[model samples]
Target chain A: MASAREMRLRIKSVKNISQVTRALETVSASKVRKAINAVTATRAYATKAWQVLRHVAEQPGRDSLHPLLAQRKSVNNTLVVVITGDRGLAGAYNSNVIRFVSQRFDSNAVPVKYIAVGRKGRDLMLRRGKKVIAEFSNLPAAPTFGDVSTIGRLAVDEFSKGAADEVYLVYTDFVNMGRQITTVKKLLPLELEGEGLVEDFGNKSTGPTAAYEYEPDMRVILDEIIPRFTALQVYQAILESQASEHAARMIAMRNATDNAKELVGALQLAYNKVRQQGITNDILDIVGGAEALSAK
Target chain B: MTIRCEIISQDRTVFTGDVDIVVLPGAAGEMGILPKHAPVLTTLKYGVVKIRKGGKEEIFAVAGGVAEVQPDIVTILADRGSENIQDIDLERAEAAKKRAEEYLAKSAPADTDHYLIMEAALRRANLRLDVVRRYRKSGMRIPPSDN
Candidate 1:
């Protein structure tokens, strides 16, 4: 049986851990709210940008003009931009993404370059000896569009310069408060489904197939629009990933707190049992001493 | 008749409501949109976006993006925009302007891309400060500096 003193110490430590976890849970819960709002706010702009790109892409023979919309002749290299949390302890949030990347790539066939957005991904990439061309970490808690422009520009530049044939963005998708799914989205080569962006902006007067008059020719505007579209897609993905990180952290911390409480309860029970056993032992010793003295 | 005007920055929706008129800083020049405007899609310059609705007007400092105008709806999608003059952090703008100016002064003439980015930053900061100062001076009179 464990001693009462040791049990008391264990209980104290477990209680302290519970306090820390509870505090972390509260902090992450609040941060998740802001992160979710940031994602929601950027949706309108992203939707509009995508809609415009789709409309432009539908213009017959227009894909030949913009480098972003054109398909590469052959796949020589791939750029994978992984978005993970800067810090760990978020319950498989980082590992799930890292594992996904490890599983997806067979680097022997086609060379791969990594652009890590968070420290966790960077570390994983480095540990695996993968080629990481660029790394951006320690993003502000509520990241702005400017914060992500650097990554976006790099990815676009690589694809346009033929350094990378294909670019993909890997991040966590925030589905709800309780569920976040890791998703890999293609960022380059401009995938345009006829009904994709149009459905999102159905309320706008520009119907699914209506072609609007371009102010300064479609080609001129597309030169400016396509890059911005790619950048915004990256920014939106980061926002979603950030929100998911917070949600996952909050859930993980809550679980830790609950587990700590259970541990403390068990420790308290053990402490009581030990104290009772010690008391019974002391009474037995006293009675035996008295009986021996009377017999003598 | 009123047009539904929406100004969305990359971060958030700065403005979305019914407005009488919206004058955007088009790539060519300042262009105005009323209710029943023809469909036009154009890129914007870094300047002020003036929206007039019900005799009261609101002005926004838009940092370059694209604008789409329909018959009844007008949307300005920008990289950055602020409708309320109060929301523009003067200190940050001033610092950004100073940094951009210093970079411009130090950069070599051969680096046109760096120079162009600095110039754009300088222009955006100037536009934001100018709009806020104008709002402070004469509540609604947008000075006719450029068309």
Candidate 2:
């Protein structure tokens, strides 16, 4: 059995660890909330942006007029826009995305070029000997559309200029407080199934159909709408992924703290039992000694 | 008849309501939009856009972008806008203007950027001045300026 003093020391150590984790958990949770709100408020704009993009994606664009949308059966060059957190501590937030990217494009069949959006992703890819096309760092705590617009434009420009044949994005998607998932999505030759909350606006039960009146011409509107819409989607995804990472980190730290607390409680119970046994042993020794004296 | 106007900044929609008339600082010229205007799409310049809402008129500084108008709707897709007149930091605007002017002067003669930067600097300065003027005319206690 562990001595009372030893048990008490163990409990104390666990308590300290629990306290640190608990503090971290609280900090992360608040940060997560702010990030979540930021992402949520922009959800409507992002969705509308996607709707516009989808409309364009359905039609032939200047890319159809231009070379960007030109497709070939054989893939030679690919650009991957990798987005992650500047800071770490989120469980598997950064790693999952990196792993997913590696599995898909880490072969000699096609040359891969990475555009790292965050510091963590950049550092990770560089260490693994991946070729980084461009690196953008020092994004705000909560990113704005402007930041993403620049990045998106750069990626699109490179593709359109025939620098890369295709483009893709890798980031996390926020499910809820308890869960976040890594997702890899194609960016260029815009996906027909554009993403968002995936429901008709303000009508969750129903769905969105192509039902709107165009003022000038559908083609002209699409041209302006598509590029901006795509840029907005990329930016929106980054914001969502960032928020989810913070929440995941917060939940993980909270669990760690709770586990530590449970361990400390168990250790305290053991300490009490050891202390009680020590007292019983001392009392028995005294009683035996007295009885022996009486016999003498 | 009146026009429904909305001036949106990146952060949020700044102003939205019905107005009697609107004078936008268009890149081409000062474009006026009344009720039942022909659907027109033109780029905006960085200058003052006057909205005669009800009896009171409100002036805003618009950065620049496409402005769409129809009979009942006057929607603007602008880059930047400011609602809080008192918050325009005049000193900073002046400093920015001076800096931009110097940059424009020193820039390569063939570079088109001097025009854009100089225009931005002028807009910044003009916005600050207009806001400051509005604050004074209202006689409202101005919250310290923010650039």
- Report the lDDT tens digits of candidate 1 across residue range B1-147: 888887888777777788789999987789999998877889887778888866767677888789988787888887764555657888888998998888887865845877887888888788778878887443453322221
Residue-level lDDT of model 1, residues A15-114, one tens digit each, is 9999999999999999999998988878778877876676666656655757788778788899999999999989889999999888877443689999
lDDT (C-alpha) at residue A274 in model 2: 82
DockQ of 2: 0.08
Per-candidate Cα lDDT values, in order, are 0.81, 0.69
Question: How far in Å is the alpha carbon of A239 misplaced in model 2?
Answer: 3.7
Which candidate's TM-score is highest?
A: 1
Off by over 4 Å in 2: A1-6, A33-62, A65-75, A99-112, A119-140, A143-154, A173-185, A192-236, B1-6, B16-42, B48-59, B67-75, B84-122, B128-147
Q: What share of the true interface contacts does candidate 2 keep?
A: 0.00
DockQ of every candidate structure = 0.44, 0.08
Cα shift from native, residue B65, model 2 (Å): 2.9
B38-78, model 2: which lDDT tens digit per residue? Answer: 65545566676777755665666677654656566666655
